[model samples]
Target chain A: MKETKKILLNSRPEGRPGDSNFKFETEQVSEPKEGEVLLKTEYVSVDPYLRGRMSDAKSYIPPFEVGKPISSLMVAEVLESKSDKLQKGDHVVGMLDWKERQVASAEELRKVDEDKAPLSAYLGILGMTGLTAYLGLTEIGKPKKGETMVVSGAAGAVGSTVGQIGKILGLKVIGIAGTDEKVEMIKNEFGFDEGINYNTTDNMTEAINKACPDGIDVYFDNVGGEISEAILFNINKFSRTVVCGAISVYNETSLPKSISVQPFLIKKSSMMQGFVISDYSDRHSEGVQQLAKWLQEGKLTYTETVREGFENIPQAFLDLFDGKNKGKMVVKV
Target chain B: MKETKKILLNSRPEGRPGDSNFKFETEQVSEPKEGEVLLKTEYVSVDPYLRGRMSDAKSYIPPFEVGKPISSLMVAEVLESKSDKLQKGDHVVGMLDWKERQVASAEELRKVDEDKAPLSAYLGILGMTGLTAYLGLTEIGKPKKGETMVVSGAAGAVGSTVGQIGKILGLKVIGIAGTDEKVEMIKNEFGFDEGINYNTTDNMTEAINKACPDGIDVYFDNVGGEISEAILFNINKFSRTVVCGAISVYNETSLPKSISVQPFLIKKSSMMQGFVISDYSDRHSEGVQQLAKWLQEGKLTYTETVREGFENIPQAFLDLFDGKNKGKMVVKV
Candidate 1:
């Protein structure tokens, strides 16, 4: 038997998750079963949606149970294998529990070629978040050349990719974030046309109008609530609004008060659509390949706020809600 | 000169338009120029959107000038013609002033044949409001068979047509209205599967759930305040929300405080599209013809809430916000 360190869920938190929500436990890892492979976790991806899974609320995805190790998109190396599909020393990315070592059935993992990109890239830009941004902008947003696109939570993982992709499609990308630093980073480094710091801006509608002078044609919304309502006021006729996430109002015990945008929809003759990445599972490979090509062509860039050790996974996720991470927040377990 | 009684703008009201906002004045008809025709107004259509036009705010259409005769979709008789296309005694429907008789350019009016449907039906079911409901549903809403479809302001002109069309497409049509009488009318007369009166219902969510057991697939929203929010809570996966009008919130000085529905869009992977009738101006005839075919086949049914005389046009328009009229509210001038 080999020793495996696991981060188990101790209890659910009231609002923002804390260290007490998780406990570091040591367990014995046995040999792989007939069709299973043993993987040693290398990197764990922390996302905003994980907070929803922590609670018992009914979401698109199921909730995580108490006393169980939190599962996330992880990059790992095979330590032992009995399955023909994977061999020892193969690096892969799959939905896996937070553990130093664990045995999973062959059906649970997909082998990744290390030569294509960095192993950690599989957990960020070239992974689910990146794919989500790509497909959402192309498939639903339908961004066109010289159009104005406004994205909320623009400094975060998915929002950053969405802004880059909007620029690639020849759209003027305007981003909205919490802090001035993050806003500057999104505009200067991420190649966004402009960035609006929500904290400093008293009138969001005026800020959005100033940023998007031509009126918003495509709105890639991640952080919903007041920001979304503001964007609605400046949308051009026949605008497309992609509802990717609503991190701003997700943790509220009761529904948060928001300005109604429904009337604005009629005024602008616009559209607001909601989407989850899983809905595009069939086109996952297409998104991944396109994003991978963009990365290789130097047309796209990504940033990760990496935390060391498996014990920091909970904190990394908490940092996402705090708007502390500039991009994808990941843990090197 | 021929004498005619016309409805003129008396003054703009501060809240909820009233009869005081209009004044009936007698005017002598002016003779048509070289390329114009004298039109005898038979049916002056009173639509909810006309209320928007009375204000000075920037909108898709320009606001009506104060102290001037209100302009709208009117069915008329060509008493005399100076254009090659039109003749004396020809029935027509066009954008015209609300006078009993007026001179219109030949280019502004389209001939309406009484043989196709009732001449008044051309003003209600085969007119702009009817086309708006038909095209908005088909082009934007895209209601599918067996899907649960919900329409707000379900007793109004567009709402009634939307519900009937939803039923024809094999949809389980659910309607939301302000009063029990309107709710009963929608269910009994318009063929809606169920109706929810928002005024009487304690729990709107529960009422929506009961009405739409499978959840709402298509929500054709005409009223956009609290009713729109209630429907948003019950929308199913991949739902399509077509925003036609927000009659409920149109008169409000400020946007309503409500819960944002952007997260639900992500959960359901849904889309909300706003549309105006003019966007499909090129296909107006196509919509009108399709609606006429359905009406002739006895597959679609419509009702008209007719207010007699041109003097009552302003009151009829105001009656829309009060939910006083069922079906299309038109003034027989």
Candidate 2:
């Protein structure tokens, strides 16, 4: 309780960032000011999007400062509260530092009901990741019953939720993942109609075509590369392609190459849209409530690949680009 | 007429096809069956989109069959009608063959009132081209007052109308064209706020940045290549890109390559949509009536590049790739 060990962005990665880019430093814990709470971190999220902030390039959100503590969604337990909104033992989620213990303003954290869902769910399935999946699919994909929906990064947290939502809406869901295990998880666990392991599929386009016999009406593209190129070919007329994340190109040192989409889009009169989750900041709770309801109804399933201890947070984050985790990749401290 | 002269698709184009791909043939005029009308072609449209139909590749519309008359929109004089819907001497527009004379069912053509607008206007402003511009802007662009709207192919039929409509909607309109003459016409005549000559501008992206001090809000992309790439860089958050046409790459035997738009679109949370005018088939009259009203009030002005004689139609169509014509290219037969 006296020491706060935080991960600092030591250096910007040239291509694929690893543990070398992060520095672990320990400091004395500070007292909570008025309207502030001292939180003991229980679970911290390591998302693919964090790779973008690791660079100094301009983006939807500013790049993380080189010397400052890397920040993301963390589920924590309030040990000391100077605010009336939260009390000791209250479980909450906040955009906090990658630290074992930290002080944050009461407004920075929101109380999470542990009785409704697990504490780690607030870092992923019932948090930003879930909202990202819901908003991108619902707002851009515009899912309709009986339509064929294809989602890339099918085994990831957002992709998993997207496929389940598609199924719940009566869509014939097909997912593209990287491994046989992920493929199996999508079909048997997430309730997708079919799954394509792009890593082993001889021809992704043919595999996708076989899975989606009726051409794809909605495509949630999370990995933008050859997989996206494959999806583009099987798109039906007026298909909606939702651009969520392109994890495939996140570590690329050069311009990412893929088949052009303009000609296909023009021929089919289709739409391709890209969005960041921050755009739906106003509708956060709507997604949370709906996701919780589905979870309570036993209609939605989620998987988490948790790495233990505060010292392993950097390795946990580095593992995301390596595709080492299933669903949400979180570190428990 | 006793004889009908037709332009036939001799062979599919192999990388920028020219007049050699067309064959002119003469045949005796056939009689109109019951519920049909015999028509004499007065004005036939030669649009850039026709270049798409010249190939056997799949698209929203069917390819022009070889050894047969190439089909497109034409304004003709109804010489005789056996149906109750039409009478002799009525001027009508319909998707008919590229011939001096032909017979079509009464339901295939809709008579146009020449008193409201010029007969040729039906092929340019008050026709499908104008509708492409209108619907693309109204439905997709969704222009707002005081926002920036940049349109490529600015002097062409659709681009010109898009810019003028942008002006009417109280938007800051910037046009991109091939020639200095077109750049001047878009500004002086069409009332565009500014114009960028892609032919003369060393850097289209820089030129666009200079023309648009405020980032682009809506981009009506008719020529999608480097120009589209340039527009992508300057897009503001939530910007809408209306993919009206990709004339720049229509003739390429290979896939078109430009900068990848995925990253930029993701960062800006923007949308890119491709649509064919025929998608609004049920709402055709709505667009036609609105365009007609704008023409009557002098709110819209159009320029047509007309070539006399059906024999010159092949060359007129070929010249589109060369950027020879100013506005809508039409043949007066």
Candidate 3:
């Protein structure tokens, strides 16, 4: 038997989640049975979407129950393998429990090459984050060349990747971020044509109007609140809005109200669509292949805010709400 | 020279439009120039969408300029033709001004077949009203046969037509209207599966949940305010919302606020799209053909509240805001 540390939900969050919402415990792990592999967790991905799972609300995916082990995308090292598909010492990735070590079925994990890309990347740019930005932009945004594309939460994992992809597609990409530093980073490092520091701007509507003189043709919305309401005014005819994530209002205890989008949509003949990554599961392999190609060609780059030690996982997740991370926030075990 | 009465927009409405906003005057009708036809207006269609044009705010179509003739879909008889395309007494339909008699270029008008359908039908079921309902529902709603479709403003022209088309397409249809009488009319006359009088219902969200037991798969939203917000709670995964019109808030002087739709849309992975009829101009003929076929097969029917006299046009338009008419509201001069 091997000793492992695990984190379970102590209680559901009310408005914003904190350390009290999570309970840490040391547990004993059993040996792998036939068709199972013993995985030592190497990287734990902490994302904003996990906040939705913490609530007992009806969503695309089932909410995580209280007093149960939280699970998410993680990269692990196969310490012992009883399956023929994966041998000992192989690096794999899958939706696994928030534990230091655990036994999982071999079919649940996919092997990752150490020489191709870093292991943590499988949880970010090469995994769900990349797939989401790619599929959501292409399938819904339907971005045409020469059209202007605006991205909200522009310094984060999905937003940064989406803006880069927009540039690759020959679009005039603009980003809206929380800080001036992030605004500069997106323009200088991410190759975005323009950037708006939403925190410093007094009137977001006027700022967006000034930034996008020709009007926004496609909008990748990650923060949905007042910023989104402002973007509505700048949308061009037949513009498409990809409603990816709403980090801004996720912590609100009550229903948030904003200017009605119906009038703007009707006037401009636009479309606003939302999607979970699993909705495009059939085309996931195609998305990964394209992302891999871009990474290999040096056309794609990613940033990671890695917090060391297994004990820091809960803090890492809480940090997302405070805008503490620049890109993908992950915990190294 | 011929004398004709014309109605001009005197001032833009502050909130709800009133008769005082319109001005009527006698003018001399000009003779037909080369390629022009002298048209004697017969049937005038007054719609809720006209309220949008009365404001100076930018919209899908240019706002009706104050102190200029207010124009809409009208059926007219050609008194004289200077073009080879039309003959005298040919009944035609087009976007014509509010004048008893006027001269228009023949190319701007399409001759309506009085023998196939009544001349007035050219302004309702076989015209923009029918086209708006059919195209908006199919193009955006994308209703599957077994799906449940909930329509707001279900007793109005586009909503009634949308609900019937939903039934013809094999969808379970539910409608929400203001009055109990209108609700009964939609169920009995329009053949909706269920009806909800929003004014009488205390909890619209619960009402919609009970009406759409399987949850709403397609929403034909004609009135976009609290009713549309209530529908957001009961939407199933991958549903589509066709934002056809927002008569409820069109006359509001300031921006209307409602519950933010982004969260609901994201949780359900649905789509909310708005469109103008002209966006599908390429498919206009196809829509008219299909609507005509459905009407001739007795698979479809229509209702019209025809108000008589040339002077009552402005009053007829004002009555739309009070929900005084059922289905199409037309003025016969």
Candidate 4:
């Protein structure tokens, strides 16, 4: 094909990103150069943390340049190769372009085993998402057996995985999500002990207190808003809070306001820490090995909300902020 | 003496505490009972943490009951010993009443050496203040040599000690205090690299950025409010913050407001944890030994603002919130 389509960050949005902020364009490309493989994109991962990269502000990750193809984690297949490390028909994953087909360097791609797990598992459960849940929970959360663990954004990819790991670690896992559907999924599918739908709950503090009578010992905070305020009020003494993402406040045009957490933190002598998955880069293989073992042993489960085609990638990304996807939001290109 | 005068928590204050909230009462006692020793107060320690106990709110320590003598850490002389573990004329430190004389259990008092250091040094440098600074810095801050460590409330007992320990560990110490006098004391007496007077500076963020050009790596937070928010904004990526106390908010009747810190924490991937000195109770001897050795070797220097007589205890405690004392505030009886 002479034409290839890709999504570009046309402009940085002031608040929540829109379709206008993203510009889609087609370009002509020949084939893979020497030491590069022509990869056909199979799955594109849309993560909430990507919103941080959209702004020019300093963050753990660099900002995405305007008028360029937005790059993210994706699972692909080797269609053609000029590199000795990769062969045709091999499955792979890398920070490839949002376009359907692109030439990637051999070192940039990691070969994935399709027979051991489905190809999409490389983007959700057995990939960086799963590792993110594992490292943040075990390293920061440090949940003890029989401790109560509460996770916000419990229906999302990272939150859901964190809940599963919390259960396997023998914690009483409670999840906070936006919708009734998400609440049902968290309790039934994700195996959470209880779920509070923040959208319908009249009083979050009372609801949280009811769900977590023992008080929250380890709080995996994925959403930072009123829900977090409630969780802060309900933390047990010496509790630990692992701040993985703040999807609720990521698109706020103004400063997000809530009850100050310092007083509660001081009274309870608690801890709160934020980290990205890349901080655990050296332990990636270790995390992946453990996650895979859990998956193969039936101790871990995952869900992926897959949309069809490459053109829908931007919408999938935007839907994450709206809490539209139940689990990992991936696009089949 | 058959009668002893001591301070009492008359009632909970609305905002900042005053003399009316504290009551001076005289209590009658016969003599020392079995396993109890008579202790005459030499120096009664007044701390910022005492404000937490004055309120009915839940805290690390129980609130003082109305019409009861408020008890705290005090350096005393054993006047009459009924226990074999203690002897008359022995100087000791214990959680004793703020009075001229009292009876204490043998195990309640730890014999402090007046030969190694001054009688008052046991309440300031070689005591809980020093231990709080030691453990919170070494255990939580975990700062490296040449890293920038910013301490708020730098003129106070705990913060002054923290700054000194930071220097001993080869860190670039920057202190934030309320007055020009304190700023000078932090820089000159404590040997800090820089000091920012929060009282004089209109723009804290700008002032902090000017002082810590390399950005803050470790922050030992003794006062939390705008100062803490400013520090959070200027923290380098992967910084560590030790929340020892929040004196600034201790007097606020409403929720203290500043820019939300969650975004900054997330962007920098930083860590913040709060703690009480007693959290390291099991390792008290470890901290006391190091502090004593530091004092004996002349590696550590200290100052104490002493008020003579028992009736001045409430005023001395109130002065802590007003930032009147340069170092530890103690009542000498």
Top candidate on DockQ is 3
Candidate models: Cα lDDT each? 0.87, 0.90, 0.94, 0.89
Q: For candidate 3, lDDT tens digit of each residue in B1-333?
A: 489999999999999999889999989999899999999999999998899899888888899999999999999999999999999999999999999999999999999899888888888889998999999999999988999999999999889999999999999999999999999999999999999999999999999999999999999999899999999999999999999899999888899999999999999999999978999999999999999999999888999999999999999999999999898999999
Evaluated with TM-score, which candidate comes out highest? 3
Order the numbered candidates by DockQ, best leading: 3, 1, 4, 2
TM-score of chain A of 1: 0.97
Worst 10 residues of 2 chain A by lDDT: A254-263
lDDT of 4 by residue, A68-126 (tens): 88999999999899999999999999987888778889899999999999999999999
Candidate 4 CAPRI grade:
medium
List chain A TM-scores, every candidate, in order: 0.97, 0.98, 0.99, 0.98
- RMSD each, Å: 1.7, 1.3, 0.9, 1.3
Lowest summed lDDT over 10 consecutive residues: which window, candidate 1 chain B?
B249-258
True contacts kept of each: 0.91, 0.59, 0.94, 0.63
- Cα error, candidate 2, residue A257 (Å): 3.8
Q: Over the true interface residues, superposed, what is the Cα RMSD of model 4?
A: 1.5
What's the CA error at residue A89 for candidate 4, in Å?
1.7
Question: Tens digits of per-residue lDDT for model 4 on B208-314?
Answer: 99999999999999888878878977999889999988888899998776666777887888999987888889988989999988888877898789998888888
Model 4 bad stretches (over 4 Å)? none
lDDT per residue for candidate 2 within A252-289, as digits (tens), equals 98867556577788789899999798988888989999
Candidate 2 per-residue C-alpha lDDT over B191-248 given as tens digits, one digit per residue, 9 for 90 to 100: 9999999988898888999999899999999888878888877899999999888888
Tell me the spans in candidate 3 whose CA falls farther than 4 Å from its real position.
none
Candidate 4 similarity to native, TM-score: 0.98
DockQ of 3: 0.92
Q: How many Å off is the CA of B191 in candidate 4?
A: 0.3
